[model samples]
Target: MLRIKLKWFHSLRLQLFVLFFLVSAIPFMFFASLTTGRIEAYFLEDSKAEWMRQANLVVSQIIQTNNYLKEGTNYTIFTNKIRELSQSEEVNARIIVVDPLGYVVADSSRIDLNTTLLNTQIFNALNKKNSSERYEKAGNFIMSTAVSIIDKEDNDKVLGAVLLSASINDIYKLLEDMESQIYFLSLIASLVIGLLSFFSSSIITRPIKTLMKVVQRVTNGQLDQKVKLNGKGEMAELANAFNHMTEQLQLVDQSRQEFVSDVSHELKTPLSSIKVLTESLMCEEDVPVEMYKEFFYDINSEVDRLNVIITDLLLLVKLDRTEIMLNINETNIKHLIANILKRLSPLARKKDIEMIYEANKEIYAEVDEVKLTLAISNIIENGIKYTPEGGQVKVKLQSDMQDVFIEVEDTGIGIAKEEQGRIFERFYRTDKTRSRDTGGTGLGLSITYRTIIMHTGSIQVESEEGIGSTFVIQIPIKHV
Candidate 1:
């Protein structure tokens, strides 16, 4: 049980429950206590006032009886009046009539007769002041009120004093009963609040529980799992973000599968061609020298194609690392473009494609010369390969204060708009037949894209089908 309770303490629902209960219950208890105290004080003050009024009435009656007696103190009449007043239901009190010397003349209780009583209330009455007091005696709460009795002949003269004392134990009992009821109601309210807190906590944690379940499913490789949260709150926003992340993961997984399939197909094609060529050579006995040379040359061409594909794949893997090694140098941008054009000029001449190089100014920028050259060479080479005879492949180099831009435009078979977005993806080709015939490995642009990205650069393609394509490269002037 202890362990279970400890575990529950870690739960968000339990924490919220405790928080809500305390937040609500504490203030309610405090105010209840304060209100109870106020009620007790109000009752006490009201009782004291009523008792004083009754005592004053008795004093008036005593003065009237003395004036009727014409001269002496009529102890019998005073005693009967005091006894009658004490037995009355409205003022069920202990009545005592004291003389001017503080000697009790008449006592309703029939005890303490002719005794000197000099309590605070009785003493105040003798000095012509009305007063009331409360105290505890014999385990009973008591309230005593005293008022002065004056002579009718001389109002200033003190005739005697009448003291009314009552047992207010019933008032305290009534207050105790009220306090019990209040406490019972408070207990009921606390129970209701606790129940509310429990359910409220459950409502709050429902979304979090759903999120946890989705996350668990996702961890188990179920990338399609999505959290269905309602309302536009943080939780809903989180759900949207999580769903988007899963979508991206799905796309990456699909892309990876495609890459593997393409790699297998690419490798298989060259190996199959070499196998067929070697088999033809082996089966043909005493074949012509020209035919034997032709088979070997075809075999050599397939092997070279395989080597290019493998080399590009290795380069891509290297570029994909979290940290790519770069031999950063401030190289001439114009000179680099010229060198790439010069190298690919032979391929261009074979197809009668004109290679053009234009530079606005001699710009220099920080770059890894070997990698950048390879990337740019691939683009220019592709332009030369795809362009028709007598077509133009134009290379331009220019720079701003912070960045250098390279543009390669070619009058080649332009890519379709829909396929342009994926041109930089590995093993993705716009025209697979054309790419195969042209000895394209389909990794050139992918390598170029990654290499440029490693240098914090961007490349964009602008193309229209049947027209031509323009490739724009932008790299920062400085490497940070």
Candidate 2:
């Protein structure tokens, strides 16, 4: 249990939660402390101001009596007056009257009477026209105020001074209470912030944790594993991107498996035939010359088939590369198509298929000549191969403002609708036995598809089984 808690404490979520909590709570706590201190200071100043006003009033009254100016005069009347003024619930203070020489004559809190008070406020109030105030800090804030008692007839003449000293005990007590309240509020705020941060961290990290699990599964070769998340933000976009990547990985894995199966099947067929023919020759004790020649020809034919398959496989590999450069040039499309049909005329004649070419005008387009010729020849050859004896194979070329189109139509044993979509895949054949007889490597259409794609072109087929098939190729007029 302790280990689990420690692990959790070490996790990024906890760290983020704590960081957020601190970010939210620290400033408020600091501001609260700052405000409390200001309030305390303001209260102390206000108390000092109040006492200064009170001292002025007491000084005004004392100056009117003129008792301090006379020698051997009793201070009973002045003392009684000071005592009466001091008896107030709101004012917790000591009031003292000092002569010009700084002797403490009458004190409301009478303990320090007859002693000379030595302080900046007392000395300044006695000498200067303005009252002076000062504060001292000990266990609690203490405030002092002093005012000069002047002769009424002559304002410049300083008779004596009245000093008031007050302990800001009430203000300090109020501040102590406020501090306690602030501390309580801060505690509550911290707890609330921590809880909110913890929940928020979970909300943010949930998707990341889910993605981590998905990544782990993918690392374990589970290519189909995907991150399922929903929202409208960066994290949601990230999840969608991850799912897209997984889909691509799954497709690549599937393609790899299919390719392995196809290659093995293609290689095994020729190898098995060659092995059987060679074994037959080896087992024959006294083979005739004609029989040896036939067996050797058969073996040579299988080797040639193997060579075609391997060559096609290598070409497919080269075409699959991302960095293969095209030898692009402006070539007359009419001339190109004419040459392809001329080259394949022998094959068409052997099959007794009528070859036809139709175009309204000569077309010119940017293309890789060798590859484009190969692609066109593959489609036309397939048409001738698939068509019955004396069947019609038509080739049409047309062009628009931006693109040129070529259509190869054949009256052939057409492909099944279900199998049409996969015709362009490597080593995919509609009729494997017939394809072998016709010397089809199964890579021809695949090469044609990839070559057109590399040139930013598209191809589509329209076929009905037992009727006919048409392959339409579209290539851009200008290479970009």
Candidate 3:
């Protein structure tokens, strides 16, 4: 039972319920107790006043029979009068009359006649010049009152004193009944609040529980799972964020799978060529010298292709890291583009394509020379490769106060509009068959995109399926 209680104590629902109950009920209980005490004091004071009035009437009667009281009368007439007063249903009290000597002359209960009254209040009343009343409390909710009895003709003559002892059990009973009602009402209020708290807690926690379940499914590799929440506060915002995170995770997972497939396919092609070349050489023993040289040259070319693929993969991994560092230098943009075009002009000449360069005399900027060169080279090389014979490959460089713009345009087989957005994605090709025939690894544009982005630059493509493509590259004048 203790263990179960401890377990319940750990629950948020129970804690919330208990907290709400205390917040609501404790003040009510405190006020109820305060009200009860005030009422008890009021009733006690009122009861004392009523008993004092009754004692006054008895004192008046004693004075009416003052001659008998002074002559040592037995108080028979006084006893009869008090007995009638005491028997009334409204008063629950004992009446006592004390003589001048502080001795009990009469008691309404009729059991202590002639007993010496040593009470301090009775002695104090015997000395008072006029009628006086004082009260004290005892066991059984009893109140004792002492009132001085005086002669009506000479109010200064103290003949005797009256003592009224009253039991207030009925008043106490009323207080007890009221306290019980308060306790009962408090119980009902706590129950109602607890019920409301339980439902309110449920409303708050339902979305959290659903999110936990969806997270569990995602942890188990269910990337497609998502949570739907109808709530209209923080919970709804949290659900939207959670769904967005899951969507990004799904995209990352899909991209990873495609990366693995592309990597394997890229590696397999060159490896198969090397294998076939070696197998041919092995089959033909003592082959011709020129045939051997040609086969060895072919094998060496495939190895170089394999090396290029590995080098690009390594460069991409380095670029993906958060700690990538660039060697910044102030280089003339026009000179850089001219150098790239000059290096690639031989490849263009092989296809009978014309290379054209247009730029300002000098446009210097702080940039990573190697990375920017690779990015620009890939675009111009693609332009030269894809353009038909006698086509023009144009390289134009322009600059503003803040940035330098490089444009590479070619009269080549342009890309479709739909494929332009994903052309920068790794291992994506507009025409895979043509790309492969032209020895394009499909990673050049991806590398170009990453390099340009690292320099805080932007690249855009404008193309139609049959028209030529224009590649625009924008580089910042200074690193931010």
Candidate 4:
């Protein structure tokens, strides 16, 4: 249960959403509170300052008006003047007068004086001096200001003080409106930021999800599938890479399938032939003595072909190991071709096909002589089998001081241009229908290719359909 809960909490979309709100809300809350407090405080202070400025003006006029203050120590006479000042449009504020000993002598509000003598509003106003302001919420929210006064005759002594207060209900209302605006803005901003984060995270995770699905399909052996993406961003690049990987996988899969199918087919044909020949021999009640040599020769030839195919397959396996190296020797090209042609000459003569050799003596090359000879021999035999009766096949060896050349040129039905390049691929027969009649396991050229590569040499061919073929082998002196 704990693990499941933890996993749910840590899920990508959930975590992203939580982080979006968390990152957006905390700072927004802090800034809103700070800004609102500052604005509200500013409004309150301004309200108090405005009220105090008005109070200073009214008190100045009252103290300057000696026409109403000719009395002795009785500040009540100024009440009518203060009341008139409080009621003025220019100074719409309430006024109060108090003695230094803490008694309310006069009030514009006309509250009961004896009962309000103990009021701190009057006492604190007397205690206050200069020009400053404070706040109160008596009857309504109000700002208070105080200024001291002196007697006209004895200007050195503070006779009494003026207390002024003003209502600031509008300021409070303005602050409340500002807070409401901030609340709405914060909510809207949070929602927008959250949606942006959600979409960004989804955009990031979507392509990865698609690539994972492609991987799943590939693992299940669907190699022909390709990814299609139209974006021009990082995701598109990743998709392209994934598609390239799939392309390589498809080619590898095709190669493997063709290899297996060809192996089975090749093996079955030879096995069936051997079985048929053996069965025919066994069913013979009285085998002719003369026919025995032909029978055994045919069987031996079949066995030789099978052995060659197996040997070539094993050689390919060993070479594929990445650790094997060829045993190199400096071999004579002219002598090599001559010996091969001599061996295959009987087959050529049986069909009345001419075997020709062209040589430039003193041709030497760096090679694994035995393997090189096998490759050349295979090429020679291929040409012999394909060449028609009376058609000419040539084995040519020509050399210079720089390199040696071996060429097997045959007058026979040649290969198509498109199929020429794949001739060196293992078990690839260009004409599948005629593969058996050609007496080939299709591993001959593949083996030849590997052998030539091991010798650090090159092989190329030029052929015209229905005309002839000339396969050229070029080898440099001094093994590299």
Candidate 5:
């Protein structure tokens, strides 16, 4: 269970869910805080204003009654009026009337009378100024507004002050309710966002999971496993690329199996022949000298054939190495082809085939002469071996500023289009029986292809079923 929880914590889906939840919830919390603060500010300011208005109304009534005039001063009538105003539902508060000396003349609650009330709002009122203040008193929030009563006869003379103090506990309660609602809404939104993130993460990781499973199967030698492609995006492209890689792996596996089979068959055939010949000589009590010589000769030929196959296989292994070094040199390509043709001239002549060489100009290129010679020799030899009697084989060389081109055309049995693609594969033969009869090991073209690729060059074949074939080779003039 702990392991499962750890895995979930580390998963992309969980990470995305957390990211989305915080992205939405954090801002919602900030907005809720800001809204609550503003509401509190607005409510406090409006309540204070209303209380100030009430204080001003009391000041106006005191002025009209001439209560502040020494001869007309009536504390009893003024106290009654203050009490009457304070009892009204809209003015539900403690109302205090203070003389200019800051002594409370009357209180609506009837508690602060005759007491010296000294506060910032009371002081400001004594100076003919109206002011309001908010503070905590007796564990309750209180808002107090104080207004000055001015003498009608002398505009600057301050009569007294009316101070109204209201409890704001209901406002706080309302704000607390609003905060609860905001928290509830935020939680709901976070859950919705978390669910959305989980699904989105699933959509993204589904293809990756499929790819992982396919890779595991491939590691277990299931090269045929493939990912099923879905919608178009980077994930789709990744699946397509993985499928292509698996296909190549499957082909390589098949080719490897075929290579083993072919090598075994090729080696076994000569060994079997040599075994039969030796067995015959041993089984016979008396053998003629001529018969002995023929048997020995046959055994020697088989041995040489076996040697050839081994040598070719070893060379292929060397070429397949990633760090195989080439003995690169600037060589006269025309001379090289000429030498190959000269060496193979006898074989062409035996079949009564005409060999021709064409060159537009003398071409020089950076190449591994020994390897390149073997590559070109194999193609030319195949041409001579496969062509009908009296047919022609032609070798052409040409060059441009940066590359050299060699074209070898043979009037031989051509290859089919479908089989051309696999001709360069190891141990692949268009006609297996004909290839064996021609003494072709089927590694020639594969070796040639790898050699050219090492030189950063390219080779292609154009052939028809009944017509002739053309092989084109292109190599860079300078090695990079």
Candidate 6:
């Protein structure tokens, strides 16, 4: 039982319920005390008033024969009348006639009838005839009195007191009994409320638990794992979000696995060819001397393609881990773009594509010279690769107070809308056929995106199929 209780307290939902029960029960227990007090007060007030009334009846009867209470002549008759009245009911009653000076002339319940009642209580009552109530010193009794006496008129103006006492053993006993009953009820009530609260908490937390399980499955490589929480409300919205995330994640994982397999195949194809062709060339008897030159050139080109793929893959790995720190300087943007254009102008000339810079004005910004140049170069290079003869490639630089912008535009075959969103994903190629024939590694845009972002910048692409594409980069003017 103790271990079970400990486990209950350990559960978050049950713990909350137990704490709520304790806090609520405290106030409820105090309220029960007040209720019991009111019950006791009401019982005592009504009971005392009724008992006082019955005791005063005997006093009223003696007042009718009140003359006997004054002198010794009829004292015996008065005592007999009081005794008769006292025995008539079960209420303990005592009649004591004390002189204004504290002499006990008669006491109905006192067997030694003539004993002097010189107690301070009797003197106090005789001195003032109005009634008063008090408890016994022992704390066991409630005592009250109604005092009436003969006025010195000898016609018997009532001058003595009637003393009434009721034992309150039952009042306190009743309060204890009521307390026991209330505690029992509270215990039962707490158990019931705790159970209800536990069930309610479980209901509220169930959807979140399902989400956790789904995320765990996803983490364990089951990227297709999805949760269903169809209850109409915020939980439903969360479930929808989880499903959407799961779908996107599954797509990403499939693409990543395909990318690895593609890399292996791409690397293996060239290496296998080079190895076979080289071995054939080494066998002088199998290969003709005329074919050696072409074979060596083809092997070198394949080696160059392999080297480029490995280099792009290495750059991507470095960017992904953020291990490459930017070595920044305050450099003139005008000089940088001029240098890049100069290097690429011969390629544009060879293809008859127009290479142009929109703005000739000097722009200044704090940036890493190598990374910013690389980002701009990658986009422009991509533009140069895809653009046909007579196509146009343009570079622009501009700035505001908060940011600097670099935009590369090309009148080349633009990407389809469906492919534009994943343009920056690693190993993602825009035109699969063109990418394969041109031997592109597909990490150019991905590396450009990561490098620009590392400088607290954003890169975006605007494109329409068969029209053109513009790649824009916005970098903060100041760096920390």
Tell me the TM-score of each prediction against the true structure: 0.65, 0.66, 0.63, 0.52, 0.69, 0.70
Clashing pairs in 2: none
**Candidate 2 global lDDT:** 0.84
Identify the superior model by TM-score, candidate 2 or candidate 3: 2
lDDT of 2 at 448: 98
Model 2 clashes, total count: 0
Of 2 and 5, the candidate ahead on lDDT is 5
Q: Candidate 1: lDDT of 120?
A: 74
Model 6, 1-480: lDDT tens per residue? 111222332377867688768876777778777888888777777667776676667666776775665455676687787677766665555555555555666666685366666555566556554454646657675645655454555534446666555566677788779878887787777777777887788776677667766776677678778788877899889889889988988887788898888788878978998999888888767566569988998899999989998998888788878567788888888789889988888878988999889765777888999988888888898898888889999888888888888889999999999999998887777766787676787778888999888898999899988788999999887875
Model 2, residue 29: distance off in Å is 5.0
Error of 4 at 36 (Å): 25
Error of 1 at 313 (Å): 0.6
Supply every candidate's count of residue pairs whose N, Cα or C atoms clash at under 3 angstroms. Answer: 0, 0, 0, 0, 0, 9
Residue 152 in candidate 4, Cα distance off native in Å: 48
* Residue clash pairs of candidate 6: 148-158, 149-157, 149-158, 149-159, 149-160, 150-157, 150-158, 150-159, 151-157
Q: lDDT per residue, candidate 1, 1-480, as tens digits?
A: 111222333377767767776776787788778878998999999998999888877777777655522355565776788898898997889998887888887889968887899877778888988988888988999998888888877888887788888999999999989888887777678767877888777677788778777777777788888889999999899999999999998899899999999999999999999999989988989999999899889999999999999999999999999776899999998988888888788899999998878897889899999999999999999998889999999998888899999999999889999999999999999888988999999999999999999999999999988789999999999986
**Candidate 4 residues 274-331, lDDT tens each?**
7887888899989887677777777787888788778778988875666677788777
| lDDT of candidates 1 onward, in order | 0.86, 0.84, 0.83, 0.76, 0.87, 0.76
TM-score for model 5?
Answer: 0.69
- Checking candidate 4 for backbone clashes, the offending pairs are none
**Worst ten-residue run, lDDT, model 5?**
1-10
- Report model 2's TM-score to 2 decimal places: 0.66
Return the lDDT, model 5, position 30: 87
Residue 169 displacement in candidate 4 (angstroms)? 37
User: What does candidate 5's lDDT look like per residue over 229-295, in tens digits?
Assistant: 7889888898899889989988888889999999999999999999999999999988999999999
